[model samples]
Target: MKFFATCPKGLEPVLFDELQALNVEQPKQTLAGVYFGGGLEAAYRVCLWSRVANRVLLEFHRGPGETAEQLYQSVQEVRWLDHMRPAGTLTIDFTGQSEGINHSRFGAQKVKDAIVDQIRDETGRRPSVERLRPDLRINVHLQRGEASIAIDLSGDSLHRRGYRLKAGMAPMKENLAAALLYRCGWPDKAAREEAILDPMCGSGTLLIEAVLMAADIAPGLMRKEYGFTFWTQHQKAIWQDLIDEAEQRREAGLQQVKSRFEGFDSDAKVLNTARDNARRAGVESLIHFERRELSRLSRPTGEEAGLVITNPPYGERLGDEPTLFFLYQHLGERLKADFAGWQGAVFTGNPELCKMMKLASDKTYKLYNGAIPSQLQIFNIRQRAVPEVVEVIDVQDDSAEPAEPTVVELSNGAQMLVNRLNKNLKQLGKWAKRQDISCYRLYDSDLPEYAVAIDIYGDWAHVQEYQAPKSIDTVKAFTRLQEVVAVLPQVLGFPAEQIVLKQRRRQQGISQYEKQDQTANFMEVREGGCRILVNLQDYLDTGLFLDHRPVCLQIQQQAKGKDFLNLFSYTSTVSLHAAQGGARSTTSVDMSATYLNWARKNFALNGFAETRNHFIQEDCIKWLKAQKGENFDLIFMDPPTFSNSKRMHDVLDVQRDHVELIDLAMGLLRPGGKLIFSNNYRRFKLDPQLNERYEVKDISRQSIDLDFKRNQRIHQCFELCRTE
Candidate 1:
């Protein structure tokens, strides 16, 4: 039989790869989907093993349709009666793009009407529409003007994998989450001294999925029923044999895959859910679940190297910005301090929050959670290199009060120490200009006796002075000093990556962590439509953070005729960009009346109508709470990092309170609407994870940019859709 394995967009390659690894034949890719030829056993196995596929559908028929009536007629032409009994319950799902037939529900209704009419006219009985559990589930795709119908052989969405009897806020789908870990090069062997960890394991999806994969356990093993079982062609013996074979494989591989798999969530409720999910998967004894935040993660005993994988809360989930940044920064510090020898992997839709991890990642892969394009960045944590002392010198001042040193002038109108051999500023400037470089002269003797002057392409200057020189010979050596300063611009381009050196002695016994340097000039880039201008420098954060890049692109692509709302509007980036992309109107909300004012400035910068843009300085949750029936076509939300708002009725934390926010926000979305929610909290998890009520896609990859080169995940971006 021909089968179509539905996977999240961008994961088709991964599903194809898995099929190839399994030696399945004739695998072909489709848009956001894939197709292959296989038998019932192959179907069962694919459902069990394909990590990236959401569901396995057995293709039944196809035809052309120009209108809803034509679609109904085409669907009725299919031999549905021969496939299932008249008394069996069935469900119909409609998807894809088709002119004059955009409503999936209406499409599904038409198809269902056709199927039932044909069945009842022939047999005087029709299968009932079973939404939750179905005997025969059919998927109808109407792309362009063509319609294809398929039988859902797996019954429930394959993500129901039976391992999760319980779930916490925003638990990940089993298959996609599993594929993410596998893509990270998760070792197949279970006894290889590898440790699998999820620092923010909401219901332990990653941890449970990892364990199942390591043990080679079939995902379908725990499922009690399948759609194919009700088909007239069902083969009882063959299905049993396949199940037995899968069990045998699991038993054979059990001892070979005894690695430590662990999950940690700060919420006790989530921890309980994780425990229940593991128990339901029948791997509770093998996997350890704990209640701990990222900051509290400790090195597991006897583990030299292991995998630390996590999906942290984003700003939308944990509604405080500063707290989220600090949380991420601390997570980075903890990873560096505690798990120096481990391999770390963080999965997030937010690139800005990922930067908080600070550790440089070695590899990054793009994965999709529904429609959201996310990044899985892998970091190889190693001990920091000890700083080498180049030189040491003793300074002695003989004067009772150090007499002011006399100034000396050199050729080319440059000043320097009288006896120093350092090159003149004018010659250095000439050499830099000749080389077409943005940086050249650094640190010349001028003004105060201890002062040193530096020039940056004549555009900027940095001057520093020291009370005494501990390494005068090292400072005076032009050849070695030039090489050191040149290496900075070579590795990181001049002007783009330039640093001035300053040395100062701190009080004894004081330890200083890396201080964020914030002295660079900020450059703004007008996002394609000129609605949003993002500053690239000044701080580690660039003007426009990348993880939200995809969502913005989606807005530009889909925002026609849509009224946009931007919550917690920092600099009104999304609103401005959306408006510039042709959104009808925009409303930006933030508590910091200051940020709302800045948002207005951003709108004016984009030449958008001050009348078309609405700025609200009220608290978001309260505002949302107050607006009972407000609806929008497009809503972009990135709540605070953490907050006491929900309790105080003033602030909100996206991670702790996203379910309420999402629930509230969904009410504010009009029929056939779209909402893009994001957060920068490193461990933000979705609350009351939505299954079918709305389509949720992680769009984090498109958010990354050169500014977040050190760490890929800076934010988590999610696209939510409500279809009429």
Candidate 2:
């Protein structure tokens, strides 16, 4: 029997090779598939194991057909009853055009009519047309005056491995992903037990395909049915034997394959979907998916150097080309900085972006992602060594094994730290529950020996260890941290992965705003009618001030129908609340472009559509002097206590400069407006003369929430207005 395995263009060579590997007789390559002679077992094997094939077709007949009636007669000549029962569902896929049949759908209907009419005449019953899932699917092709009829052995396209539950913005098909890897020589690398990584794995499709290849697991094993299962010529015994053999090989392959497989995506949702897809693929345990940006991508430690492959977004919009260039450049920098002695493959639709990578391609293969032309650019990363410390910041080594501890489990200080955390959790957990709070501080340096601040953000925890004083013993501090890392996950019922650790130290001014790392791991937590995004890993502050919940709510309440102004707006969470409160217009001012951009995203997340909301990038103090015609009815001013940085021209000390700052800000307040001035400096004092100039009432105690009850001096807030 002559069979044909069809695939998308540019994959015919791989498909032809795949069929030969399956022991098909005299396989030959064609435009979009491979042609071969095969019987029941050979056909079943090709359908089950050919990753590059789109459909496996069993050719039955070919005849001359120039007109509709001639096409019908040609199709009628085939033995339709032997293949499909009268009550069975059938679908016909017709392609190409002829002199009499120009439209594909019209041609398909004529062929369908021929089959149904013949079957009905033979048994007095017609086979129904199933548009979606049919018991038997037929493929009819006509060009010039020739008609060829074949039964599709693979019901659905083999590209769908039945694993992907969700796709990212743009997704590459599984078949194309497999072909790209095969073109990159993944089979040879897997045989050598080398690792595979997709640094920009949006939905983990590439990594999932790579794992299937490494484990020798057949992709078709995940599907419950195929076209061959509904065929009359299919031998059930032979099919079951192949399935049983595949299962045994899958089990054994998983055990024998030690190659590390992993994926990284910047989007948390994308990473989560990747995990779900891997889980559904039955290879969840074989791969690692983590939330990470391309800029911070590092080498997977403790794994054999093999290949780094990715299909980054090829921005298709009018203005997307420039942004892709930036991304491509960043990707190249990361690849050069970390991945040494590894093969790299990047499949992208836009060739202009490839120029930004700066690395010359060792080999390039032409491919297509759907209709858009794409290139699979490959490069070889030569091994180079220089620095002892890797440039990647906060990089977690996935392959590292914990050392067997011969040291004591817990020291005297370690036990005290654990006990304090337990006491704080018991006390604060109840308070948080009663207050309807999703985020709060659990512990804040309860013991000087174990100086740590632990704050819970929904299911996650942010732990900041205060830089131990010089007088403290280094060994004890090390032991204290080791014990905390080991014990917190067990005591809190929260897994260790939920905890983000950082060292806390006093920054004299502008240093606090400096970026600790370029990696951005953002998550949103609910704060009273607001969903605020926080970056737990890349900054000194988690974007949202947990103690300032009351202030944020207060701003919202007073903002109705008012023109709101927010100064030194770290992330503009207060401005976001104001907009939620029906503010007529709101303007947020800050010096950091990063925070301003983040604030705009916050507004976008809340679906704020009005153009009245605005963000300005300028030093709050400098910008205040320029404010003349713009009068705000509600204002929030929360400046850093000390700021001496290169970004700002003026060095500011809030304590020494509070009077000028307050006078300038109040100048823009309308006649009946309110000004809320706040700062966290414990020793902050109000100017005596301002009391006579305006109505100032210290609302510090009322503004403090239960979470900060232990530290009442966490912030000082005042309601100040014109003394009308």
Which candidate's TM-score is highest?
2
lDDT of 2 by residue, 69-110 (tens): 999999989988889778899999999888899999999999
Q: What would you estimate as the lDDT of candidate 1? A: 0.66
Candidate 2 has an lDDT of 0.83
Q: What TM-score would you give candidate 1 relative to the actual structure?
A: 0.55
Worst ten in a row by lDDT for model 1:
386-395
- For residues 205-237, write the lDDT of model 1, one tens digit per residue: 888888878888887888888878787877888
Task: Evaluate residue 148 in candidate 2 and report its C-alpha lDDT on the 0 to 100 scale.
Answer: 89
